[model samples]
Target: MENQKLILVIGGTGAQGSSVVKALSESGRYSVRILIRDSSSIHATELAALPNVTLFQGSQDNQKDLHAAFTGVYGAYVNLNGFSIG
Candidate 1:
């Protein structure tokens, strides 16, 4: 695992995020950690079952959760939903 880069992915069960997670997980170059609102969800469960992948239960609005999820990760992929610049 030390040889692979660690990436933290937000909204990883969603359409766009899932694609990113799938590509990265299959590449063998990254150990992926995904932040999901519900770890028990079917999508989350499937992702958790994949090799070199981990699921952390939390929301993007929670700073504490994000801090924990970001720990030791080399990079992050964030997908925001219903976000507006205003």
Candidate 2:
């Protein structure tokens, strides 16, 4: 397992997440994982192929899945979906 710090990017397949993922990946210092809705989604597909990128397919409202995504993670960049609070 990589000992590098992990960055859990919520909404990672989204615009901002994409930027962060790209920047972090280029930095060569952090391992990036994304919390996505579906691994089969096109956005997820794109993120999954990124170097040093991992995907956890779940939404923010699903605490179980969210917890799994957070597991062993060092830090998080979260942008909660609006519908999640409603």
Best by TM-score: 1
What residue runs in model 1 are displaced by over 4 Å at the alpha carbon? Answer: 83-86
**Colliding pairs, model 2:** none
lDDT of 2 at 27: 83
- Model 2, 1-86: lDDT tens digits are 27679999997877787889888887878999898777898878877787888888787889899889999999999876577558
| CA-lDDT, candidates in order | 0.91, 0.84
Instruction: Let me know the TM-score candidate 1 reaches against the reference structure.
Output: 0.91
State in Å the error of residue 71, model 1: 0.8
Model 1 worst lDDT run, 10 consecutive residues:
77-86
For model 1, how does the per-residue alpha-carbon lDDT over 33-67 read when each residue is reduced to its tens digit? 99988899999999998888999888888899999
Clash count, candidate 1: 0
lDDT of 2 at 20: 91
